[model samples]
Target: MNTPEPLASTVVIKTVNLGRTLMDTEQQPLTILQGINLQINAGDSVAILGSSGAGKSTLLGLLAGLDQASTGEIYLNQQPLTQLNEEQRAQVRQKVGFVFQSFQLLGHLTALDNVMLPLELAGAKDYRKKAQNWLERVGLGHRIKHYPNQLSGGEQQRVAIARAFAGEPVVLFADEPTGNLDQKTGQTIIDLLFKLNRDQGTTLVLVTHDLELAQRCQQRYLLQDQQLILQTPAAVNPVNAEATP
Candidate 1:
């Protein structure tokens, strides 16, 4: 695939001819993604729907600067990611946030403390007040003193969400965030997520296998054949898309 032309200033994320290759057990090359060109506008809610091994997470990692691509370039927040070093990338990440399936909370920290970590790292003042407010907003104020182990799976995830949004990030990357919860619990978490997303006007890049969840986003992409194809015109049938492993 060819690199796309420069997008408008509103574009928060843009990838050109992106690809990733890794070595298998025999040291042979395994291409996980190829020629994945994507553009995400600010405040856009986009979902990347694909099978388990379709490189959804991989692509997300590359775009988020958690990992690097083997080929091509990625520009995040209009800054060329490929040109930045690890420290520079870390600085970039400070402007972003993440919610994971495992609910990456600190076991030793209370929910309130966990949510405060990001703000503290960013040298923001009044961290306690801001974190407390976010926790209350997520309906976790009652459990703010509890640690990750003391909370239920849903509560833990809620803390994760609060932590992600407390920083008022420019973008939020969610990777199977609901994968570890039951249907009811997942639905609750999803509701909270979108609520905070809208309230904060944060750009959302969600990777999921759930079609219903994907449909909730404003833009959708079906990742197949190591490429990203837009599911626009509301005519792309996801029912026929390949299943995740």
Candidate 2:
């Protein structure tokens, strides 16, 4: 008999009965997440859809090793987040990238420098060239020398996206990525995100209130009544469904 090829390793982020509770001044616990279970495979693009106060961002923070859940477990790339100390979790963060809605660029840093910050901190050489290349990829080549204050909101957001991709993180997460821009600019950023997805094979997880944007992903999740729920029978366009098969 012929020898079988080795099975590919599985890369996934998973959570079981994950929960969070906030304590008020009176010491009463207000539960935000209850029994949340989520699983995301490598190279999967997913949108976390929910209204405000639905614990969407909170869940992201926990999964990203930013915060501890009150109950349950989270495994990121087969490592137990709960078992890792703060420093250890920081190490894990090296393999993950994030984009924020607020365009969290430093006012003093130029677009190019902002994108180079992470790489330089990690002691990578030739950071300038790599940063410039990523900025160019986002169509911000001419604006690379511009400071955050000198750039428009959309331009700043593009810089942020460039920075996120510069790190080459295995998993990418975004919170309200397009919430701060005009419809046209936002649409452009969305297109760039998809391009990165197609070219880099990066796993994307985003939290958004926009239905149309969420529908673009392969999977969509909602936080309902303190639970993480995945809705099946995708609302994707019929054209897309037929093309998949």
Candidate 3:
């Protein structure tokens, strides 16, 4: 008989009835997300598709421990986020990586230094070599010395990706990673992202308006009306169902 893996080992992130809300000056409650539940297995690629202001990024932020939810539970690698303090959550976040729509690269740092930042922060030795290797893998070896403004949008995104991967996080969350690029460039970035995700076996949870990109993931989620729903019929083209907002 084969031994089975622990639940924690198989599931990278899980949530139950997760929700977030805010209050206006009048203390009027504004609900953003409610009854949001999700599960992402190790090495799985999942995408959450929604129009603008549908709370996709908000949900991602909550799951990533970047923002606290108003209610419900979130488990990251079997650790309960609701129970962890802000400082503790920050520690947890160190084990995860993120790629944002803006690329989020520091303008003053060269591509190499940008990639090296996380590794250095983690006190990892030989960060320079590791960062260089990741940059080369992303086809930016020759451009490692280039600053963010000196590089094209695609090149800058590649540098951001390299930085995200350098830390070897257990999971990666990406929000509108290709939103700023042209279609052709977006496709290239998508290919690179999925390839790296596959090669590294990193769990991927992405939020995007791009139907084609979302379809590439193993599972699909649609955020609507402050709720998260699984894509039905399994073969429906998301783009045909809703316009990218």
Candidate 4:
């Protein structure tokens, strides 16, 4: 696969022939994905849908600059991520945000403190003020003082979501963000995601198995048998597509 030509418009992220492989215990390389070409326009919301073990998480990690791809190049704001070392990668991280299915919040921190964690680390002086503002926006103002264990699963998820967005990231990536919550709560979080997209024009890349959620995104990609499958706009809801051999 070759690099897809990035649009004339400014894109927040661009991948050139992206691919990834992992090493198994037997010392053999397990090919997780190959020939992935993607372009994310500024403020575009992209949803990645696939079956279990389809490398959704792996793809997200690679895109977030947390993991390196075996081959290919990743550009965040036109900066090549593969060219940068780990410490350099950390610098680029300030422009991106991520939320996981497990709500990887600090177990000991309160909701307010958890949301402030990222901002504080980035050297924001008004971390507390900004964190509280986001908490109130996420409808978790009352739960501010409560620890992770003290809040309900839904509340914890919301806190995680707030934390991810609190820093006001330019690009946001979420992996099964609503996986732990109930249906109603999941829907609420989904709404929050779209709301953030509309209000802030944040570039969003979401990975999920939920058809409805995928449909809501501006663009969608489906992975099957380790290949990139282009999707039509309305095809976000589980449409049949041929898997690459």
Candidate 5:
């Protein structure tokens, strides 16, 4: 038997004692997440798993700096998110990309233009070429001129993926990238995600309820009872039976 090679030591994202709390309808305190400590290394694929309303998305939002933690600290590429202002955090988010279950493509924009939007905002010299290249890479070359509504669900998701990688982000956060598609189509999207992750060496942090999808990641954490629990391979199979969102 051969031992697998260890992941690189570079930490792209780290959190310490992270927590989030919200007020209930009556204004009483309700805790969504608490005491989360995690370290995601460079070029690693990580998955956050839990039942619906288990604070999985909350954790992802905090990790990506899209939302603030009510307590504790988060370090993104060594920049402290807990200390950054909104504008400063937005600046830090430039190195990140996102894919949503809804696909989140602008309906009015052509696939090509949708992919070009971020690059153009960043003032890339050749946004069109870069967008076209990514579209081609995602096997959407022929449909670049199509609008989101004109494409199939899977096709729209491909464009979304192309848009995400077009910026060459250091980390990609996908919240149920395959949630909208049928099982077969979802599998195709999953394969594309991992291929892009490996080819681009981008760190992947995925939030999903699908056990099979979570299993594909290098590291898996279950968000339950307001805590993050690392799952061993042996433990994953049992979770799969009941894992649902």
Candidate 6:
């Protein structure tokens, strides 16, 4: 599959000396991330790899404006997130989408409803049509009426992906998106993710422990010991090249 070239040099996400800390059981401050500085260009795919408990998800949450940092600042679409209060941060997140490992779907809502909920909340027009279109794009159209419990893990994830892209977000943050699936299922999900990234030009910031999945991205970083380390040069998609005939 062909990857889309970045639309411009626009920086969709940037971090400056970003750090996060939490109080431990005994009241000692435990630093999870520190001194992290990075810039993600529009239409780029970035992977953050780390062992479990290395704060990869924490960093993702901060970058997505779902959580505030203990120090430093995060800018999403040129808006400073660290300086914004919760409500203000939510306004900034209107342009953002998220996919999680646990599928994060409401048990009672059908797949279509799950995808439509956010759009409805945001007051988007023709939200039902948009939701249906996205579900079809993710190959879940036939399962639109199925609840999360009725679908397999991969199917549930496909619904989640549909929900994420339906909003037409500028950036998509995925946390261990394929963590619950078997290897084969995970590969299918990864392929779907890249295909959407290529087609829609959504900047992808993924957090995962899977190095193979990380290699599929344009840039890869390893989060370790409270720091982010660059693991590869940007704009290199070895997996895509190898997939070419």
lDDT for each candidate structure: 0.88, 0.84, 0.89, 0.85, 0.91, 0.89
Q: Which ten residues in a row have the lowest lDDT in candidate 5?
A: 1-10
Backbone clashes in model 5, listed as residue pairs: none
Error of 5 at 150 (Å): 0.6
Q: Candidate 6 residues 1-245, lDDT tens each?
A: 34323323499988889999999999999999999999999999999876678898899999999898999878898787877788998899999999999999999999999999999999999999999999999998899999999999999999999999988999999999999999999999999999999999999999977667888888888787899988755432455323320
Best by TM-score: 5
**1 versus 6: better TM-score goes to:** 1
What TM-score would each prediction reach against the true structure?
A: 0.93, 0.90, 0.94, 0.92, 0.94, 0.91
Model 3 TM-score is 0.94
Per-residue accuracy of model 2 over 1-245 as CA lDDT, tens digit each: 44333323555588878999999789999999989888888888898876678888998899888899899888876677877788988998888889999989989889999999999998878899999999999989999989999999889998999999999887888998999888898888888887898889888999887665777889987677898778664543445433321
lDDT of 5 by residue, 96-209 (tens): 999999999999999999999999999988999999999999899999999999999999999999999999999999999999999998999999999999999999999987
The candidate with the higher TM-score, 4 or 5, is 5
Query: Quick one: how many clashes does candidate 4 have?
Result: 0
Instruction: Give me the runs in candidate 2 sitting further than 4 Å from their true place.
Output: 1-8, 233-245
**Model 4, CA-based lDDT:** 0.85
Count of clashes, each model: 2, 0, 0, 0, 0, 0
Evaluated at residue 68, the lDDT of candidate 2 is 92
Question: Which whole-number lDDT from 0 to 100 does residue 105 have in model 2?
Answer: 93
Clashing pairs in 4: none
How many clashes show up in model 3? 0
Point out the higher-scoring one by TM-score: 3 or 5. 5
Minimal lDDT window, size 10, model 6: 236-245
Question: Which tens-of-lDDT digit does each residue in 155-203 have in candidate 4?
Answer: 8888987888887788999999888888998999999988988898889
Compute the lDDT of residue 7 as modeled in candidate 4. 50
Error of 1 at 9 (Å): 2.4
lDDT of 1 by residue, 57-173 (tens): 999999999998899999998777887899999888887899999999999999999999889989989999999999999898899999999999999999999999888889999
